[model samples]
Target: MLSVVIPLYNEARTIVRVLEAVQEAPLPTGIGREVVVVDDGSADGSADVVAAYAASNPALGVRLLRHAHNQGKGAALHTGIAAASGDYIVVQDADLEYDPTDYAKLLQPVLKANADVVYGSRFIGGEPHRILFFWHSIGNKLLTFLSNAFNDLNLTDMETGAKLFRRELLQGLMLREKRFGFEPEVTAKMARIPGVRVYEVGVSYYGRTYAEGKKINWRDGLWALWCIVRYGLFS
Candidate 1:
């Protein structure tokens, strides 16, 4: 079974659609899917929407968890990861930026190629990508470069949210970061695991504009830089 951890906040508009897409996505034969949604204190009716969806679609195996107040994405992920009961875990955002159909592509390395972790990179393949946010793209590349410099891993999209990992391997790590910094911090820690085999695959990206509810900002990039240096060198 694969546990899909979706960390969301104030995504009332896209939450239900993304959940439906996840349920409809086709997985490898004999592989079952379980969705673990962590609502990070969304005030925009996101939690209620998820609850209603769960109640109506009981067969989808959707498990909804909530935080009393808004915590960071990492905190929500921490909660979801701890509650996950699958053999493998994959992080999925409630936003429409990532395509659910690509889950199988990211799982290929772990399922067949024996990868301990797989990253769905938005910068590698011939897959279609919505061209938006020039500065965001530059920042992501810079962060990925800095992270690679410290962790010594050749990842093209270190900030990507679409990551798949062996459940035990992930739950065993001592994670700390909470916000957008979760990306670099986890990557840094994952690289330190002895004999850990990490692979990357191309995935489609349908980025959202600021008016369309994109939440990450320049501050998160700075935090990620600090995380790369702190976790990479000290921890």
Candidate 2:
């Protein structure tokens, strides 16, 4: 079984679509999975959508968690992870930027080869990038480079939304990041542990503009940089 964790913050436009995608995904035989949505104090009607869906489909076990105020992405994910019920866990964004169909590809290594962690690397050799934005792409590459430097592993996309891991192994780590810092924090702690194999699989990513509820801004990039450094050395 896999627990699909989605952190939400005013993602009403895409939350329903994401939920539908997760519901439609064809996980392998005998694979029990759960969709856990964490609402981080979204002022919009995002929570309502999740509740309505869960009410309509009782068998899906669509769990909804709420935060009174706006916490960060990491906090929301932490809540969902604690409530998750599955052997494997995957972090999914509640937006249409990523394809939910790629869950199978992200799980192949972990399920077949007994991998400890699996990341969806957007830069892996596959299809060409559909969007053409140099500065944003460069920033992403730089973050990935710094992450690889500290973790001692070469990866194309370290901050990809799709990350699958062994449920029990991660739950024991006691992660501390509660914001955008979650990415580097996970990489740092995972690096400290031995005998854990982290591999990146090719995946598709669609970049969105600010007009479309794109929350990550220049400030968040700075926070991400700080996270990479702080977690790399101190954490």
Per-residue lDDT over 55-130 for candidate 1, one digit per residue giving the tens place of the 0 to 100 score: 9999887999999999999999999999999999999999989989998998899778799999999999989889
Candidate 2 at residue 199, lDDT? 77
**Each model's lDDT:** 0.93, 0.86
lDDT of 2 at 27: 77
lDDT by residue for model 2 (35-54), tens: 99999999998999899989
Model 1: residues with Cα > 4 Å off, grouped in runs: none
lDDT of 2 at 135: 81
Residue pairs clashing, model 1 = none
lDDT of 2 at 174: 78
Question: lDDT, candidate 2, residue 175?
Answer: 82
Stretches of candidate 2 above 4 Å error? none
How many steric overlaps does candidate 1 have? 0
